[model samples]
Target: MVDADQTFVIVGGGLAGAKAAETLRAEGFNGRVILIGDEREHPYERPPLSKGYLLGKEERDSVFVHEAAWYAQHDVELHRGQTVTAIDRGARTVRLGDGTLIAYDKLLLATGAEPRRLDIPGTDLAGVHHLRRLAHSERLRHELKQLGRDNGHLVIAGAGWIGLEVASAARGYGAEVTIVEADPTPLHRVLGPELGQLFADLHTDHGVRFHFGARLTEIVGQDGMVLAVRTDDGEEHPAHAVLIAIGAAPRTALAENSGLALVDRADGGGVAVDESLRTSDPDIYAAGDIAAVHHPLFHTRLRVEHWANALNGGPAAARAMLGQRVSYDRVPYFFTDQYDLGMEYSGWAPPGSYDQVVVRGDTGKREFIAFWLKEGRVLAGMNVNVWDVTEPIQNLIRARTAVDTEALADPSVPLESLT
Candidate 1:
């Protein structure tokens, strides 16, 4: 049933779009593949933008999904620096920013997410930054290096993953850092207070300052350059630069304009898709950060913005577009590396979902695995400085069976046995 003349168009050139195109060829589909992206750079993974690449541990080329020649050799029509302005679902064609229209037999909207901008004034000042794109990382890297050499100070507006990671990187470069958050602790929404304190302590030990229970009200600047930031608590901190790491918002404008079904903002806004990653329009599909998939295993709609989701979701969407059945039920997974601590989290455990948290190893030594359990069933797991346990951890979550609390908290007990 693979039609050689059929054309498949992919909008967005991030990991999801690039991998989908790769999967199409790998799955023996010789159809026309057209990929469009606004960014001039080739498709690349995003994790490095906050981790290795920002810290100067990775080369620029290492972040790319594929070599520059790979697309040409694979017969993929790569359209870098091109934006798909409008998607006409009825016409089965997409209008580019330059007024070009491309027809497609099947379409995939992998058009990821964008960083949420600070609503306060002085955000347009020259020393204010956001870390979402490779260009942003590159500029920040240079700024951090210069600041490190001059003993400059960086004021971060949020204590989220991006903020903490950038704070770690800035500290590594010997730049002074101060993070301000409205929550009581860092990662309050994701890890909760029980483990959020651990990250706060880790960063504090590395000389990173924390201003909790407050939010940035304005960025004070002079001559279009940031000089300091003022908190709602009437506190002003001297800053050579400011980073807005609040969060990201899914780019769902094109989908909305095309009348595609979207999840309500209250339930985590995104393009609504079934387990197959197919949208309300059968010929159109959504993937990556933009797709709020109705997970078959969890029996709920979930939108994962991490790199793992994009990595696997792309290929799954590709297979589904090829007339193959695909149920994307991969557990939500993400990792972080800050200072000397590295950790991986698996599964979903939002605030009211879990009743208790259990730890398997030593917390004082910064080596432990925390499990959130609801009614004795594992809802999520996080291993800090723990190795080679993702498989068993994911298996435990997938099983959805009640696990003994004592055994779950015992390091000597094998996790595989519990599952």
Candidate 2:
């Protein structure tokens, strides 16, 4: 057993940091482990924040992954409501939001990303919001609670995941929401053109208006309250509130300032990491949204920002820290709930990768599984309403199984047959 005095410091107590602490303890790491986070709340699952939690179907406590007693039992030190201000790589010390320094034997930076803000005029207005933290979701819930009597409109600035989820939440509150995307579709980068169009239709079915091919000119407001939004399409939309969910960039100032090597990605920007989730510095490891992980299947370094990523990557990183020599090799899984049904998508269905998509049910029927075929094998699959196939499809994709599309698309064929 490692010395109890040996300290393992984990920065950022989100899913990644919290999971790392749990794994270290489970691995018989009796050493002192500390988890630091900017948020005061115990580490909670974030996926429900937009769906069930924001929609008033779930309470705040339900979002929490573990309670206070769990951490107490595990002997994990969770320092919430604090920030990590700086890092001294030369001495292996981390500085907190306050002027305090802590030495560490191993440092794991699960420093998450912050939602990018729109730099238009009047963006500082009061009703303008972004969904990234629990506090932000709480504010949204408050605003939503007032929807029936007071709320009227919600302008979503980005068509990304958070933006779409916020839009869904607003719709759930009976607010007339409009999603203004600078891109053509909400999930243009993540999903290809056709699937993006399908999601656009999904939102439209729920009375959510989409302003595609739009560039936000300014956030028109008065007296610190947002009143309207002006777009480059020469249209002004009235709104009671606005959600800025454009995108998120990895928070890497502490790492870059500490002379860590950052990898530049071509698809825009992302942080770089090696196979073991280690940064340029051997002693420091990066996980969660902040690190660009080397994908074993894709043969690329991809930055993933899903709840599944945090849930899985954090443990894989912990194993690596324990000399288990494990790499984070797994297909990504993410889900979104529209008004009536849930859409769960797995893996990166890159453009031109899928030669054909076999639909298991009618696309217009509101429940179906579509398998992405690349050279006759299932590369990825997107499902709406039917969730039972998600696991089997993921398994097939990982095993690189060649699917019989003729049988898969048949109405009588069970999803288990593909496995």
Candidate 3:
């Protein structure tokens, strides 16, 4: 068992790692805590990278999880821009990029996911960007300002959350925007056809163009700068800048090299962990985007990438490190903001897991709560442009009682009374 006198090492200084270090101090652990990250900045939040930060409404300091002085006061060593090269599980040590070796009694691997890069030609062009870090957002912001001056077009490669959010931000800057997606509708896999159509319509109403069932074949460039994006059908869309938002893959290369077991990529790949976030090797734990956790609530192994999972997974891993028996059973939750719509969703039901969707408000008006039911049991619920209904929606999911579809669809019936 890890005690107060031993060193606890945390890899990847993102939200999950920072929160775990904070939890250790809050739980009365007086030992050394080292948080290592490859980036040159303190641990910060990523959701704002595409929203307020990219839009210039949020300042750089506001995105940080904690102030720089907080680490010093808490006695946690902040090692920025340092990469962990290897993990020696037998020796309980990690080797840094600069050949420094650090020993730890307990280690937490929070190495977060990386944005999936486009492999087509011209990916190395000057105006092509991927949104994952603060630096990426800063570059995109500068590019957007330049496009605003020229009234140029900004082409987004995918219609996912990042793609649509950036489209909204670019449109706000008075730039022509277009989104290309292979799916029939935006967010179709997660929200299904009917709801995905709503998002597609929302973007269209805001002056953003969409090309559905389109796949990028190559990015055309001139003098090492992006000029246009060419699709598979030999169609070229003019682009002053191109943002790739093709989703992300788990950062599991470090764990794999260290001989930790990982689930197959098809099965939500990452460092496989049980309910308490303990990896195959008991002394090490993983959380955030890098953990393929066995969720007790879903009864399936899944890896979540949203803000809520990282916020909750950090503290749970800390408790397990302290030799406390803990189970991670929190319902998976996430939210998205696009155009004039704001939504919060709770519970989990993968694509094809539910048979019916019951909506309480108006889908055409974009104000409603949609519930995905499997055999009358509420599997998931989402509130779009609706406020203060999250608890009631969550309670209905937790009750796991079969709900009547007609009652669920009736706007007069309160959601809390469903079960």
Top candidate by lDDT: 1
lDDT of 1 by residue, 1-419 (tens): 68999999999999999999999999999989999999999999999999999999999999999999999999999999998999888889999999999999999999999999888989999989999999999999999998999999999999999999999999999999999999999999999999999999999999999999999999999988889999999999999999999999999999999999999988989999999999999999999999999998788999999999999999999999999999999999999999989999999998888999999999999999999999999989999999899999999999999999999999999999998
Candidate 1's displacement at residue 266, Å, is 1.5
Comparing 1 with 2 on lDDT, the higher-scoring candidate is 1
- Candidates in order have lDDT scores of 0.95, 0.82, 0.90
Which ranges of candidate 1 are over 4 A from the true structure? Answer: none
Residues 187-218, candidate 2: write the lDDT tens digits: 88777776677778888988899998997889
| TM-score against truth, every candidate | 0.99, 0.94, 0.98
What is candidate 2's local distance difference test score? 0.82
Q: Order of all candidates by lDDT, from best down to worst?
A: 1, 3, 2
For candidate 1, the per-residue lDDT at 78 reads 98
What's the lDDT for candidate 3?
Answer: 0.90
Which of 1 and 3 is ahead in TM-score?
1
Return the clash pairs for model 1, or none: none
Lowest summed lDDT across 10 adjacent residues in model 2 is found at 263-272
What is the C-alpha lDDT profile of model 3 across 1-419, one tens digit per residue? Answer: 35578999999999999999999988888889999999999999898999998988999899999999999999999999999999999999999999999999889999999999888998899999999998999999999988878999999988988999999889888889999999999988778886788899999999999998988989999989888999997789999889999898989989999999999988878899999999999899999999999987677898989888888898889888888898988878888888789999888876799999888889989999999999999999999999998888888888888998999999898887887
